[model samples]
Target: MTMQSLGDVVGNLVDGIGNERYWRGGKIAEPGVYAGVDIERYHHDPDLFDGFSISSSGLRALLRRPAEYWWSSPYNPSSQEPESKPALDFGKAAHMLLLGEDGFAGQYSLRPATYTDSKGDEKPWNGNATSCKDWLAQQAKAGRTVITETDIAHIRHMADALSRKEAIRLGILNGKIERSIFHKDRDIWLKSRPDVIPISSGDFVDLKTAASVDDETLSRAIFAHGYHVQAGLLRVIVREILGPDAFTSFTFVFVEKAPPYDVRVMQLKDADIDIGERQARQGLKLLRECLRRQEWPGYDGFDQHISYIEMPSWAKTRIDNELNAEAA
Candidate 1:
């Protein structure tokens, strides 16, 4: 008998969910390759890896606070209350409309107007609103997609605007969407799900709902969110899993959550990705070291050291300009 590959071992474990082979009908399946399953399965499964999945978001967390990462990561075998995030819900709805297989029908239902308030606002009637809300919750609990009619409209507006962009439309003409890929190196399991992976071009695209897509605003947002890290790491992982022919470049399609629903397809050039790769490398090295030591420290001797807060560059630049003006 030959030893199974790590990917096969993981896949078998996940496949045993709700069966006698593993947890004996456990509600949540283990982490592994699940073909012909809802994409949500990959997103909600907490038991996907014995150690840490080291996601791009998790990389950011590791960079921020190692102790928090250690305590909250799957390796700790601890749990936390699943709090509802309205922003995340809204983003999921947008993702459903933009990338999911069923488009709108798979995620939402309609309700009729039921009651008129004293302020003259008519709410959905016949308990329809409540019913829809309950259904949405149920769908989410089942690891299925769900959304609102208002969210649908918002998505349509963004789609229409995006369609107007000839280059982007051409780039996204035919590609895979919402496919989760994982790479395990030693104890570290790196995972990424590109929103869209272009087939022939080998370029991936991620959809994001943001407040603004302006040059400066989006640039700052990208930096603040560590999206570059995500982009760089995802490219490397996809290549590692699927091979060098699988990933070449990355792009982010940013859509405004409100109003005219402006859409911007921002492509990170080699230069930007180079910086991201450096950051990712640093985070990965730190993560590996912390995991090996099993001691997640906070702020590297922060208790003993006295640190000074420095003025931000933008503020310092403004101050310098004002001082120079005064001298003139």
Candidate 2:
């Protein structure tokens, strides 16, 4: 018998999920603003519309890598489970705590620093130990996600920092949280879930966790993480669902995860939204064509022609400076 490599094992897992269609039960979600949809259901249920629907994140993937988008989409046959990251996990926990969700104790548990062994001896909790593994399994069976005690404390501090900001506090207090919105535009199904929507005020707010909220870093992050795309998509969805006159402003509330837990609030300008919306529309067009042909292409995309390479601007500048020094 041939032993399967780790890559093969992972590949098989992905194939299994894809074949199962992520077990969404094939129910079609109607296009509208959903107030109480579970976050899990919103993420996993790809048949939310009559056909495959694209979220802001999906659009970003489609724009950057069509093949990646195909595999990451729960509606596609090649879809795979997204890999979890520590930072993402931490951010999720923070969101749950800060978003006015009740019963935090029911959803999350902190791993005890020490556990009593069967022999009645106290030992530090070793994750690799069989007893520790069993303990974690029990937590899972109890329907509680396990997190570090330190993380719990950090989340509390982050929340406190946000509460100190007058605009953030008022915005959240006056808004609905985690609303799922689905709309059809130009024969394409699109979805968005804004973190907070102050309908009365016509202001929308999104929460983001970051390492730094400095101007330069946040500006880079906005483009790098396709936040502009997200903003653009939300604008379209909100306008379609509510009305052109309903949306007055869109803001992002960013909080640091570490010490001091600084907070910053920035609202997108009209020009920024325009740019983001244009990019989103372009991505949707590309996605429509790929879906129709059932052909998701990677960066190379069946192109076999040899391509010439150009030196990077920084490298070229360095070489020129060196040549000038030699002449001097």
Candidate 3:
């Protein structure tokens, strides 16, 4: 679940309610912004490994086509031709589970998680023939343990956190609130619909869950990318919602949730805002290159306009073997 606010969750657990909201969802056209790392890896086309032909103009043209234009929207891809590119499949994969909580269409395709045996042997748990109960029936038949309803609820909660907005709040605020004032009338939006309005904290809050937390490195980057770019966008929205004082300051909450939660509070200044705007323009240049090519977003983006990120020269370096081979 994505968190929007940072309230004390340690001892004041009873009095203070953490109004958590995730900013990663809703109506954003930017790919990978809302994508789960696992889902992004799963949906990416592995066959487009040849790299780009004209990586500059081709990519630029592709980005421009969709600023407010039409691209092919696939309806049903499994029945389509091989070269047609399973876009319908991609869209369906992204959104299918969002509409239903108990949906298990992806189950048949998913490989079982690795587990240990009773005798203390580790093995893979997939491609088996088993008939157990409903959820654990297959696992039991494969010499695996039966899963509890509580455990299943956890997995469902996790997937919803990744895919649906409804899961966002549930995953973030679970085992905490028994009755929430945020929802009256028996959780109408919470119960009836499969989604909720994308969360808004009325301010920017950036929380980083990592192994070892560093507040300094985090603030610099957040001030550079997350706060500055989003602040320009947020200023307009916040102004409309709560008037002009909303733009008076930029608020950032960075929380490192490991064994203990260490929270840091910081703000972005006018200079940092300038850096973010410059970076956004650099990003848009890459987007423009993508537009020119009609190429879809994929893992092999390094071949194109990603800002020559590590292109600066070092003091001393080994020869470029690939470049040498080409010359030879």
lDDT tens digits, residue span 126-152, model 3: 334231123355643553333333334
- Write down the TM-score of every candidate: 0.69, 0.82, 0.33
Best by TM-score: 2
lDDT of 1 at 265: 78
C-alpha displacement of 258 in model 1, angstroms?
A: 1.8
Expressed as tens digits, the lDDT of each residue in 143-168 for candidate 1 is: 45444567667778877877787766
Give the residue spans of candidate 1 off by over 4 A: 1-41, 44-46, 68-72, 81-83, 102-148, 171-173, 298-328
The models' CA-based lDDT, in order, is 0.65, 0.77, 0.34
Model 3 residue runs over 4 Å out of place are 1-203, 219-227, 236-246, 281-328
Report lDDT (Cα) of residue 85, candidate 2: 74
Tens digits of per-residue lDDT, candidate 2, 124-148, equal 9888877899989998789677889
Local error of candidate 2 at 200, Å? Answer: 2.2
